[model samples]
Target: MCLIFRIILTAWLISSSSLSMALSIDSLRGVEKRKPNVIIIMSDDQGWGDLSMNGNPNLQTPHIDRIAKNGARFSHFYVSPVCSPTRAELLTGRYHPRAGVYSTSEGGERINLDETTMADVFKEAGYATAAFGKWHNGMQYPYHPNARGFDEFYGFCSGHWGNYFNSLLEHNGQIVQGNGFIIDDLTDKALEFIDNNQNDPFFLYLPYNTPHSPMQVPDKEWASFKDKSLIKLADARTGEEDVVFTRAALALCENIDWNVGRIQNQLKKLKLDRETIVIYLSDNGPNSSRWNGGMKGKKGSTDEGGVKSPFVIQWPGTISSGLEIDQVSGAVDLLPTLADLSGINYSIPKALDGISLKPLLVESNQKWPDRMLFSHWNGKVSVRKGRYVLDDNSKLFDLTTDPEQRVDITSQKPELTKALSMAVVDWKAEVLKDIAIDNRPFPVGHPDYKYTQLPARDAVAHGTIKRSNKYPNSSYFTNWTKNGDYISWNVDVLSEGDYAVAVYYVCPADEIGSTMQLSFEADKLDFKIAKANASGMINQQYDRVERMESYEKDFKPLKAGVIHLKKGAGELILRTTALSKTNALDFRMMMLTRESP
Candidate 1:
């Protein structure tokens, strides 16, 4: 069955089941009046209490706070314990595991290609769709934004970027240099997209990578809080140990707020503010220890502070102003709610784990449904009912009394715990049923990526046999030196064509003549080290964090001739053929350039 036809039938069935609901996505094409435009602005690592609206006294975020002041605020919003999974959940309206992303750059951080994205539904319904900022989901074709129903994508494909200033970014799959801070650049691109598509309804996803790691912020922004005396956060009620890191995180968030102001202002100026549904949220909990709505844990843990992100939505005239909805919502709810508002619906391979929040958002103080929300990370799962939480260890907590989750009350409420436990077991079974364990391979014959970098640090990225990083570039490949080591990259080829191969490594004078072979399917090509030293260049253009100097001195190049390739799913292997003087030269990455017709 064709996707459009399948969706049309599914929409009719689902809509018939609930006659009170709006029309399904597939039928939105004929509406003469413009549908609502959507702009989802998600921040990285900005916790529940990061905003002054949530009562953090260290910094001020008036612009972001305005969302809650002007629209509906979801006080108990939840997300994944990490960045990537939450992103997958938000895009697919399903649990992260169901979307095929278990963690960041590991356990299939790349979303499954077959899964239907929110962009797919909106684009199908005649909405121009674009994704700006961090797209931690996938780097390969079929999983990339352009392939996953997004008409335009401007951001890095990796899990995270290293540098924010004057960084190289992917603009519609082409590497384009971005000026100024990343947050500003992302918002500027979003404004440009909005301007270009003002005549039509558009869906814009802006996920900003701020306050997550590397702890780098603009000097002027940091200087404002750098000199302030260290003090405990009002909500935390305790002194923070790392003031510098927290201050930097705060400055980065405030910088994001400034950009949010830009977006909101642009919307109002274009008179699209009332027609666009603007949402504000964070990917996960705070990276540093500070006030996080008085919750107990930080990022990567299945705790309130870890997964709870502040979510505020403003759909002018449709959603009433200054209302607070205390429903327990999660990132999975994003897609469904967007679909409901846009009146687009479709049947996907996996059943959605989220319920639409359209009723609560559009109707004032509506009766919200109470459903169990489950979260899992690092082998531990946390399930939440109305006021209760059950962790994987069978420890239970009454969130009403202990929002911080400081005490485990499993013994006090064995019956509640038992029921929640059974629910978690069932939930996990449902979400993990369709998960594919194999790595989604990089595309070899795709036109989007001219050069593919197979790094050693990625979860699927590994050297079967090798030495470790001696001189490290935290963002690039590290392992090298073993005599018969081979690094394999799982990838999908969209077409059959020839490609030029290059091996990036460090070679000493004594081991200059070593050779490595690139093999795919039944074809193999060999490249020899031409020089004793590496080429004075760097493949990792963006810094994950702020840095001072260029770290490109140790890298040299080896040009391997082109090999005629048969297009299909296969592993590309860089195998050590013959060592010249010592072990295989320190391997960095293998680059493949797709040959043009």
Candidate 2:
């Protein structure tokens, strides 16, 4: 069946199911009002305890807290253990693994094209859709936000950016420079989008990347927590908390709160506050072992702390203010909940993994079903069902009495333990069947998109050339000391065309003379690095705390002419034919702009 017909069928079927909520609309003299606008603001690496409202005394997040005070707060909410999966879940209303999101960077981060996103649903329902800030789901066309039902997208597509201030970013499919700090710049663009679409129903997704490392926050924000004393630290049992890093993270969260306030102010200024639904949430747990309400595990673990997130929603004159829901929700529920609450009919193209939270929010006395929610990452799976948790190792714990998973109650609840264990095995067998191995190649030169970007994060370095850091996102290929050293990417050109290639790189004044060649199949293009661009790292100068990811440099893009490539799959390789000094250049990215047909 066609996509449109399938969605129509699903909508019809789902409307009759118990998951559907009554369409909410205001009528004046029998004239129907416009649909409610949606603005979902998500933070990166900000944990449940990062907010002052969440009982953290280190920093303040009044703007984020206001969402809870004005509307509803979910006390027990869950998300993926990492960024990309949570993003996939939010977009599709399905489990991340079902959508082929197994990793945070490169090809694995791309959601399968077959999966329909919430943007698709909203756009199809005649709502204007745009996404601002970090788009970790995918970077290329088709998988890119532009093809994923978002009319406009402005941000970096990588998992995490290296620099946050006046850094390189993208608008739609074109590369551009950001205005100031990334979070602020993204908010500015979102405000512009809202201004343009004030009269229309719109879905705005502002996914902020912050507090996630490179530890860069504005000086104003950094000043507040630079030397502030902390009363709460990461659990003493873990013993891995760094005070400086914690301070930096708290400062970043405060900055995010400021941006959140800006967004709220914009809506209020436009008089759309009561007409729009605003939500605030974090993608995962804390990036570091900071104070997180004494919950176990950090970002990568599938425990309560790692997967738990603070979920706050504000819909003035609609959702009751200060309504604290003790029900367990997850990132997967956002799409359906928003669609149902807004009266927009959309059906999951595949089997839906999330149910609408409309009953819990709108119908307080409704008989909410007791369902199990699963959190999986890096081969660890944990199931949460009504205050009880079955951890990855088949150990059970009642969260009401043991929130830290300290005492395994398997002996006390043998039957429940066995049933949950078998459920995990069945769930794994079903969700992980297709993703056991990834043989897909990165795509290039789609007919619909004019430009294709292949950054160092997606490339493989050969010989003595090594990546600047262990984390691939926003990293560069350096130490290119040998002639045979090269960087390559497995790519499939979707269209045959002549593409104008540009290489973003940096070379010292002494090591400026090197001939670099890029080849795919039998086609080749050569460029000489005759000029020097000695741009040093920028992170150390701006970072309030030490960073683990590679610092970014202002690499100049060298236009290396054009090469005609046929439609096919092959290794796109970059190597030096002749080196002048000890190194060739610090390679950052390659851009391919397809010439007009």
Using TM-score as the measure, the top candidate is 2
Question: Per-residue alpha-carbon lDDT of model 1 for 106-127, expressed as tens digits?
Answer: 3267888778888898998888
User: Given candidate 1, what's the lDDT at residue 543?
Assistant: 30
RMSD values, in order shown: 10.1, 9.3
Provide the lDDT at 457 for model 1. 40
> CA shift at 113, candidate 1, in angstroms?
2.1
Off by over 4 Å in 2: 1-30
Cα distance off (Å), candidate 1, residue 39: 0.6
Give the worst 10-residue stretch by lDDT in candidate 2.
19-28
Q: What is the number of residue pairs that collide in model 1?
A: 13
In angstroms, the error of model 2 at 58 is 1.1
Q: Give the residue spans of candidate 1 off by over 4 A.
A: 1-32, 234-240, 407-413, 432-436, 446-453, 456-474, 478-486, 492-494, 501-516, 527-561, 568-570, 575-593
Error in Å for residue 216 of model 1: 1.6
| Candidate 2 C-alpha RMSD relative to the actual structure | 9.3
Mind giving the per-residue lDDT tens digits that candidate 2 earns over 1-597?
A: 699999998988887663333322223234566899999999998888899998998888899999999999998899999999999999998899999999998788989989999999999999999999999998878889999999999998999899998888989878788898889899999999999999999999999999788798788887888889999999875568899899999988988999899989999999999999999999999999889989888898888889999999989988999999988889999999999999987766597888899888877578877888999897889998888989888999899988877898999999999999998999999998887688878889999999899999999999999999999999999888888689999999999989999888999899999998899999998889998889988746669777888889997888888998989999999998898899999999989999956
